[model samples]
Target: MICSSSSSSSRLGWRGAVVVVAALVACRHGQRPMPAPFKLAVFPVQNASGGTAPIRPLTEALDAALGARGLEVVPRGNLDAVLAQHRMRFTGGVDRPMAKVLREELGVDAMLVPTLEQHVADAPPKIAMGVRLVGTGERPVVLWADAVARSGNDAPGLLARGLVTSSGELDRTVVAEVARRVEAYVSKGAAGDSCGDAGRFQPRRVFRAPVLDDVGRRSIAVLPFINDTPRRSASDVILGQFVAQLARSGSFEVLDPGFVREELLGHRIVLEGGVSVDNAMALLSLLNADLVLSGYVRQYVGGQGAPRVEFTAYVLDRRTQELVWSSSSLGEGNDGVFFFGAGRVHTASALSCRMVRGVVDHIVGRRGPLGPAD
Candidate 1:
């Protein structure tokens, strides 16, 4: 009897040990591993400072900074070639749809969109820059963003003198600061409220009218916008941005602008004063489109330090010859700082992009004005 009891005790101990080992292994496997460093594609830095300044040095400086931070950056030449192959102009901005294309084509995990806020070669050499790191997926995310503003006199005499002589030094300093902020954001894994506050610098205005149920599935044609601003090219800039936003929404089948232009020319129909019912019907028949989008650039003013944009849009049903939807947006650029005279300026392109985004969002049934802190 004693021998049998001892054997039973030994077997129970072995069973308990096995259970404990299994539990330990399961625990180890349950923990998620840290993600690998992102394979990043740094797009060409957009020049939004309203000047003819060369942006090559700035782009190189940013690449070097990110490389030092252990990021694998796509080479500039390769990026440029891809852009050319796709017939894409580097507009210093990439909407969600474009980002998806870049991800699939370039095999990049994320894209870096940087804008030159201020790049002056004046005596004190002012420079400001903003950068956004966007993740690529079906739903794009703004993973990180930070802006840097600096004046030559902000640094010591030796450094300030170097900035005056070589803009490369200034670029490096700004890029380094941006890299530092981005690193901190990644390590924390949360942007917190402070990052949310940074969005206050730009505000968005959105308006929406009732849209037809089938608008989402219809093919759309964007006519040439009427240019009311002094700048002859303002209409072209706004039109390109508007089309890009509409395409990004994925709510409509946007027809090719070149095709639309050619068809309009063939019909001898100039949409200068808006589309007449008969003209609209004829054009729709020629293009076999479902809807027509027309807009007028009410305000597109850009100067040394201030840029503003305003536009109104209308959506007409091709079959009914009735206006189905209307939306308008207004935006102004401002440097985020006001107290110490250390603010960053916004460019005309940036303002127009914001306004177009607002209009698109409203048309897609997302009706709400973006707050300052959005």
Candidate 2:
């Protein structure tokens, strides 16, 4: 009996026992359920400031800020590795394939795409940025979006006591506000109040709507605007503003531009001059969107002086490719600032957002007449 027992114990020695225990522990850990199905992946900050600005620092700060908010964020290294593996560098929006990759491969639920539109190192630094959260599902949709066009001096209190001097400091401040909004939507599923036609930043004229009011809750695709302005990628900056506004309106499930871009590429579609009816129809069939929003960015410039943004936007029905709404909008930073610089915008990105929101509001019939801080 002793000989038989000794042989059995030798076969399953201490090392085997330890290995069995470790395997059981790992299995237990693997069985533990995840708190939620949603995990956020933040894309690297895109530098659309048209100048050299610190991108890495802002990206790291934003990632850290989101993590501090208790949201599960996929590590930056992991997302970047995936991006490199797939060679996915488009920042306009998350294409469907990229979304699938992030969702299945990396387990990323949503995406936060931030673009620095304008930045200037003045006495009081001015920065304008647009942040958007796009849900990574079958249809990539913008869940929550916000834009900040701010100059430190825009809010200086008595005796210039509250001036923001450093761009880095201002970056964190703006980013924190945005992160708070993102976390709110993530935890409570409620975004901040929409700022539609609230400020002096409004389109000068919004006219001629045939089928605009009827297109509620419909899916819309905003194509890239023609960058006629000298500012590099001005069209992209304004397109982002429209995307942010349209998403914020809660009136339409604005398709992610990256997804739209991917479709356009696959179909070999081109917008030579502007989106023709044929182009719109092709996009309509491909994207299954109710409307297509296309535009031309004539002037989008901001610097030492008042920022100015001018553009024309038109929406066409997907089935008929008939014009639904076509309007031209133009605004300046000091459009209605009458007081001692009380309500003035400092960056083109913010100004464009304001102008675009006004147009979106008018289309949805939610805005009041042109005014200041309504």
- Model 1 agreement with the true structure over 5-59: per-residue lDDT tens digits: 1111111133323433443454467632233344678877776554666688777
TM per candidate: 0.47, 0.84
> Which candidate number maximizes lDDT?
2
- lDDT for model 1, on a 0 to 1 scale? 0.58
Candidate 2: residue pairs that collide = none
Worst lDDT run of 10 residues, candidate 1, spans 1-10
What digit string (tens of lDDT, one per residue) describes model 2 on residues 1-374?
Answer: 01001111111233323433443455457642212334789988888888888889888888988999988999988888888999988765788888778877887667889888888887678877688877676667676677766788877888889988988788888778777877776664454643436466666656655556554326789999998988887888878888888776666767888889999999999897888888898898898888889899999888778888899998888755588787788888888789987778777777787788878877767422211111
- Poorly placed runs, candidate 1 (over 4 Å): 1-209, 335-345, 366-374
In model 2, which runs have C-alpha deviations exceeding 4 angstroms?
1-37, 193-198, 215-217, 366-374
The residue pairs in collision within model 1 are none
lDDT of candidate 1 at residue 302, scale 0 to 100 = 59
